[model samples]
Target: MHATHSSGKGRGHGGGRGFRGAGGWQQADLPPADDAAAWLTGRLPDDWFVGAPTITVDREEIVIIGELAAPEGSDDNSAAAAAQGRIGRFREETREARMQIADEAEARYGRKVAWGASIGETKAIFTHLAVPAMTRLRHDERRVLDTLVDAGVARSRSDALAWCVRLVGEHTDEWLTGLREAMAEVDKLRAEGPDL
Candidate 1:
């Protein structure tokens, strides 16, 4: 069954956690948005999506991807094209309203908001942020990235590293999910403990 809102559930691991890193480029403190999915579900209009959207939150942005109702009597061959057209129409139609919602969400959550729509096998994101992160790697790790770059698998070391990370993420999604759940539990326990 489709739900209008997902109560008490969201994939917001490091986004809401207070920032305590000592690096100059590290982000400032952020408001906890464990309920970001729920909040967005409730805040969005009812007719916007066929059901509840899948929301993903990180330290920099919140992305909401909702499934749009399929076009009636669309054949298999035309379905993808129809879906793409619908997505474009939806984007143009919802520009103003989406901006307003994004503004409100950004103010409330201290992170940028991005929206997307999906239909059948087609999916589209309206906007998203690509926040740069600084990292140092050992010789072995740098060699791995360099190998990918040398092989033309990536244009640069950064792209190679990103490709590697994406590969790892796709392969270990189940393990990552479990880890996130465990971390959420730890966060809950920490919140219940005495204030420092």
Candidate 2:
């Protein structure tokens, strides 16, 4: 069945010509993928998902998560297992097609593409990119990560820092949404400005 689904909440980013780096790409140089959702929706096979996948884009990666119909005859206790089986089957069946699409998307967007599928209560990300993010923390901030490592909450400072970021993101989603909206507005205003 043909279904219409959205990528996710759209957020606009600044647009302009930027310089590229050797072996790596600068965020400024990356092409704006404002139409990524529409593109994927059109490119993906109609029978692959119940609806359009939710596509999330960042400077380094693009994640596409799609929902699959849950298998029948699954009880509450077995739902997760059934969903997992369905997800695994989908992954194996779609691997070749997904890779081809990822290749095309990466070439077009200059960012890695990851795929995920969800059915019932289970969601599985088949492939993902782990791009290192460099950050400099003050002594106090560094100590906080060290403390987490020492407390066995994380394996290392990097893990601790990632944990902290996820925690903050989970708690401040609403605030972050507002911030993104404001940034989108700024991008809109900037785009309306004179050509330089």
Candidate 3:
């Protein structure tokens, strides 16, 4: 409930301690270990939560210094560490849900997406351009994205992403006309099955 400016290096403009009242938010100030127990129920799967301990976000880098004390010694691996680190950062259901969507998109379309920068660049594309949502596309055109999603012909995630964006770029206004209905149709298709 409080924020003390993170003393990250390079004291350029805003360097050093500034305090906020208890109503502030700090990424490092996470729920207690027990509070994070439900983090197991999140997408990454339970064992992947690494130590399954609560997390706090401070220091230039916070160290999660423990691995599982599994009797079978199967606990030491990067996968679990990655999950805990990934899932621990979600602050609410909306963020967690968005993360889930992005994660799925990354996984299916971008398994090779290594760092945040790449994902961020993709985000920047959407930020700068007027991209279309499912609602924007025609009933038949939605087939394009679905087809790509289904065939998996795009192979890597980036390829799939670029294809969808390209489709949007070609018909931005068409999509904008009946966005709500389009979205509903797409959502229904999504619920019913994967893309064609």
Output the TM-score of candidate 2: 0.84
The sequence of per-residue lDDT tens digits that candidate 2 reaches over residues 1-196 is: 0111253212122223232321122455787777788898899999999988889887778899999988999888889999999999999999999999999999999889999999856898987987677877999999999999999999999899889989999999999888767766766777778776
Q: Which stretches of candidate 2 lie above 4 Å from their native place?
A: 1-26
- Measured by lDDT, the strongest candidate is 1
Q: How accurate is candidate 2 locally (lDDT)?
A: 0.80
Query: Per-residue lDDT of 47-99 in model 3, one digit per residue for the tens?
Result: 43244433222212111221332223224555454434433332222344435
- lDDT score at residue 102, model 2, on the 0-100 scale: 90
- Between candidates 1 and 3, which one is better according to TM-score? 1
* Cα lDDT computed for each candidate against the true fold: 0.82, 0.80, 0.37
TM-score to true structure, per model: 0.84, 0.84, 0.17
TM-score, candidate 3, is 0.17
CA RMSD of each candidate after superposition = 8.6, 8.7, 22.1
Q: Clashes in each model (backbone N, CA, C under 3 Å)?
A: 0, 0, 7
RMSD of 3: 22.1
| Per-residue C-alpha lDDT of model 1 across residues 111-158, encoded as one tens digit per residue | 999999999789999889866656789999999999999999999999
